[model samples]
Structures are given as C-alpha cells and as structure tokens.
Target: MNTRILIILALIIAGIAGWFFQQQGKISPPVNIEASEVDYEATDIKAVQTNEQGETEYELNAESLTHNPVTNQDEMSGITMNWEPSDEQRYRIEAGSAAINQQTGELHLSGGFTLVSEDKVSENKTAATDIEPIQVTGQTLKGNTKSRQVYSNEPVKVVQGMNRFEASSMKANLETGEYEFGKVAVTFTPVERQNKALF
Candidate 1:
C-alpha cells in the first residue's frame, strides 16, 4: 500500500482531540487553588463524548488526572482513548502522560504514545482477522484541538502489514488527511508472485 494511504491512521488519531475538546468544556474549571497548586484530582478517570445522533465519537480513560486552576490545564497519566469516526473504522490511542489546556485547546503528549487503526467488524466478516491494522508510535507529540493539527519533532514510526516507515519529524492535519514529514525512510515487503502453469 502506498504510504499516502496510511495517512488515515494519523488523521483518525488526530481526531482524538476533537472529541476531547467536548469533555474539556464540560469539566468545571478549578477554583480557590494557589497558582502553584492543583485544585482538583481524580484517579481511574473515564470520559466519553457522543455526537448529536447519540453515537459515541470517542472515549477517554486515564489512571490519574489533576487540574491546575491558574493555567486551566488538566494533566493526566496512563491515558488511553478510543475514537470512532464512522462505522467502518476505529482508532485506539495510548499515551504515558499528557497535558491539555482546556481554555487554549493546546495539547502536549509525552512519555511516548501509540495509535492503532483498524477496520470495524461486521456480520459478514471479522475485520481484525481479515485486515491488517496500522500502528503509529512516537516519543512526543503536540497539537491543538481547535486547530485540528498534530505534530511530532521526535522520530516517529508507522507499520502496517509488512510495510514500515520512519521519519525524523511529522506534521499532519486532522481534518484533511494530509501529512508532511522530514527525512523519511520506508521499507516495503516484496510481493510474491504465484507461478502460473502455461497452457
């Protein structure tokens, strides 16, 4: 498959923040905490976002979360998120640590992160067994929900089927399915041709 076709994985994962923006807006802003202190804290957190049609857009979970009143920021650890853009595809995102500025829509993901994209299974077939999933991994990422943009300055890796790609840096538009990379290297598995008996 062309690497360009793999851009979907990046776009779907970038959309992770789009649903997160809704959750951020719903959480009450912190109050009465000192500038250097966190006003709210929680463990084993789970947040879900749904569309107007009552369909789930994304679900987010974290091992722990803390809110800074002064910065209007939420810091979380052991984060995992699942996003469903449509009935055909699903994306899973995991991160070690993240911080989001609810007010500014700024997001910072660090301590490594991984995103996997797969087709949804239907009554006719098992998607997981039939189709290969695409995986994207990186050390650090930054983005803005409002802008629907995500980028990484650290090395990034993507794998699908027998294909692998590595890039020194990457930038992608969440809405447009466009990607840009700096210093990319790709390794593709050779296709095997079946022998045909000459008639």
Candidate 2:
C-alpha cells in the first residue's frame, strides 16, 4: 500500500455515506429491534438516500438483510454500496457481510471485501501511459461515518496500474486524502516506451 495508491483508495472510500448517517442521526431501536417478524428479514433490497441539497448521495443493495436484536445492529450479506459524494468522484464497494450499529452508524465489514470500482481522477491521468484501474482486497474493515475514514488491521493487497502492493494494516483519511500503511511491500512494472508518428 504505497502512499499514492493508498490515497486513491481512501478518497474513494471516504465520504462514502458519511452524510447519510449524519442526516439520519442516531437510529433509536424500536422494541429493542428484534427480528421477530418476517418483515425484519428481506431479500434483494435496494435503498437510495439523498443529501441535504436534494442530490442523490448513495445507493445500497443487499442480497439479504436482517436485524439482530441481540447486537442491536443491522446485518446485511452480499452487499454492494455505491457512493457519489461529488459529481466528479464515484466509488463502488462490495462486501460479503456487514453490520451497521443502529445507534452510532458505525460500520464493520468482514468475510472478505473488495473495492469494486473508483472513478477518481489522479495526477497520472494525463501521463503518457494510461492509468489502469486498480483492485483492492481485505479480509475485514471498519468505517466511521462521522469521521469519513476507513481502517483495517488485516492484511491489505492492492494492484494499482502496473504496481502491486501489500501491507499488514491500512488507515485512510478521506478528508485529507492521506493513507498510512504498516510494513508495506511493493513492486512496480516498467512499461516499454511507445513510438509515435510526428506529422
């Protein structure tokens, strides 16, 4: 997880639904939020939430959803979250399973996670060589909607352009677009120069 690559991921994942929770505020449990009825569990769910400016901010889709009263959390499996914090940037995240604290809006995802897509323009966008799409994977992660940050203590692997990186841990500050990685290993591939015709 190089600093540059890490920043790319952080910016994409940060600001992801932060305003969603801020607007919803604390979700108080009703009747302790036990999944006592069939309605508490649903399949193929899609949710769209707008921001204060009446602009669409995020969309969440899940294969199945359930409320866990014992933990007071909303549990979702096979989830895909898409966030568009601004018109210029968009990110798509996929998780095997996730739990959102009903009261605090804290989110924890586990059982493997991937950043499916990100459309943030980087400085290398205008480089002679095109910037390739990157892929990121982690076993578990935690995110705070309040701080707009994501953290992972598990191993993180990223493939950016022609570079590959791995780290023992990762922390991304979306606000500042900074990434901190622990004990990182990285490899870069050099591309051969292409000849162009000058008329």
Every model: Cα RMSD to truth: 28.1, 28.3
| lDDT (Cα atoms) of all candidates against the true structure | 0.80, 0.75
**Model 2: residue 48 alpha-carbon error in angstroms:** 1.7
lDDT of 2 at 140: 93
100: Cα error in model 1, Å: 1.7
lDDT of 1 by residue, 4-93 (tens): 768987788779978888777885665665455888999999988676699887788999999988778899999997866556657787
Best by lDDT: 1
- Model 1, residue 181: distance off in Å is 2.7
Question: Could you give candidate 2's per-residue lDDT for residues 92-175 as a string of tens digits?
Answer: 778999887746758898989986436566465753334455566899989864465778998999777767899999887544
Each candidate structure's count of clashing pairs: 0, 0
